[model samples]
Target: ASRTETVKSVYDKMLNSIKEKKTAPPNAWLWDFIAKCSSKEDIELLFDMLQKLRIFRLSSLRIHENFNTALCREVTKACVRVGAIEYGKKAALWRHNAFGLTPDIGSTHHLLLYSKQLNDVNLLVEVMKLVKKNELTIQAGSADIVFSICSGADRWDLMTKYGKRFVLSGIKLRQSSFDMWMEFAAKKG
Candidate 1:
């Protein structure tokens, strides 16, 4: 079947499942498929469906070269609503916006990755400040992200600062892991 037809079928099935207050296996598959959509209309439809279905995993969506500002805005808003703000950070890394959209902890963590990926000291520092300022929670899995970003950016100061914060957040780092992170942060710095 054509893409439109397939999406329609998936939407119909998903709507039925929602009406019955049940999650169908095929609905997950449909979400997986929709996340890959690059067509503008399809992507919008997918976002709408996402809002309706409450499917929030953004590790599956792949932004592309053709994605526009409107699409990016929609994605960012959807990510925020679904608690997938990390994905929004990836989108922001690809394109900057003058309009403020304060990223959540998940997005800040992703922004940290983007900063390291682009070697953008300014962006990295900006994200670090947000996390440091208590605007964002250093949630679970954030420690790993901090370690990776610090390793990439060779940002020992922020690493030490955030690492200490992570320790205080009650994440039990293995003694070896803690030592290794410190060593790496030092070496990179």
Candidate 2:
């Protein structure tokens, strides 16, 4: 069978298991299938299955720490691939909020990467705000993305703001991040 067919078959089985109140497959298995989704239809189906898992309160599908982070990143990337950029943002935020998982830096990092890809300063600012609002711990990788975005957009103000924020938070940014910030500052001056 084609890869799509195989993925669909797995999706159908997972959905049916939930509907039948049977022991659903493990979340890791579902995550593997989620990673396999390539098309918009497949992603939509994946979202539907995720919703079913939530609604059914499937004991087998318990979300552990970092599981939701991985799931959100995959879902966001899948949606972005299908030209559903807005949907990707919503799905990521929904997954973050819905799961009650501790605010994770990885989830925001994925969003920042996409915002950088789109050269979307507004989206970058929104993600930064979300990070602050949720008090998500900032990591070097996330700081790198923010610096990249600010440099790309020539938004030295943003770079300075987040640069100070990172220093204040005692997060040691990478050399590359510092290089980008310095280069951008020199360019602006």
Candidate 3:
């Protein structure tokens, strides 16, 4: 398990599998494993092994049944954690644009929240661009955080825009988002 293992042991085992040319595991299992693992250092090692195995994808990791959105989301989160925001956003875009499939909502939320927490406005804008490109409604996790930020910053325009996005997104605004919006309104008049 990732919990008990040192990075060296995990990397070595994965590398050995690559050396032996073991068949690639199912994409689902692979992504699930990545989600469970801690540390970007270990994740980078896993990705290197994947790359060496010749399965490193720029985007759109298709499986036997369908497009792999869950994996895309997990990968994006990992990328953000490691401060690889642009790379993560581009890969997500590539996944949708190149493959003609929408990004999964979970990933969308995760990417937005992570970017906001990082205080990366550029990455947040890029993620928003991707959302429009893919025709996705903003998911709640992302919407709430953005609202809070805009409110705190007194960026009335941004607050309004995010409010519209939240409404159009049709995801219920969380209490924090609602509370922030009210605070913004109270301060305005």
Best by TM-score: 2
What's the residue-level lDDT of 37 in candidate 2? 77
Clash counts per candidate, in order, are: 0, 0, 0
Among these predicted structures, which one has the highest lDDT?
2
Q: Which residue segments of model 1 deviate by more than 4 Å?
A: 1-9, 12-29, 32-43, 54-141
Clashing pairs in 1: none
Ranking by TM-score: 2, 3, 1
User: Which scores better on TM-score, 1 or 2?
Assistant: 2
RMSD of each: 11.0, 3.3, 5.2
Better of 1 and 3 by lDDT: 3
Distance from true position, residue 29, model 2, in Å?
4.6
Model 3 lDDT tens row, 100-147: 223666767677677667666666667777777776656667777777
- Tens digit per residue, CA lDDT, model 1, 108-161: 554555555666666666656646654456665667766666666677776787
Cα deviation of 155 in candidate 1 (Å)? 1.0
**lDDT string, candidate 2, 1-189, tens digits:** 775687798888887777675665677768777778777777767767766666555355564433356667777777777656555655655335433323356656667888998999999988787677766778889889999999989898899999999999999889999899888978988
**Candidate with more favorable, higher TM-score: 2 or 3:** 2
Extract clashing residue pairs from model 2: none
lDDT of 3 at 15: 58
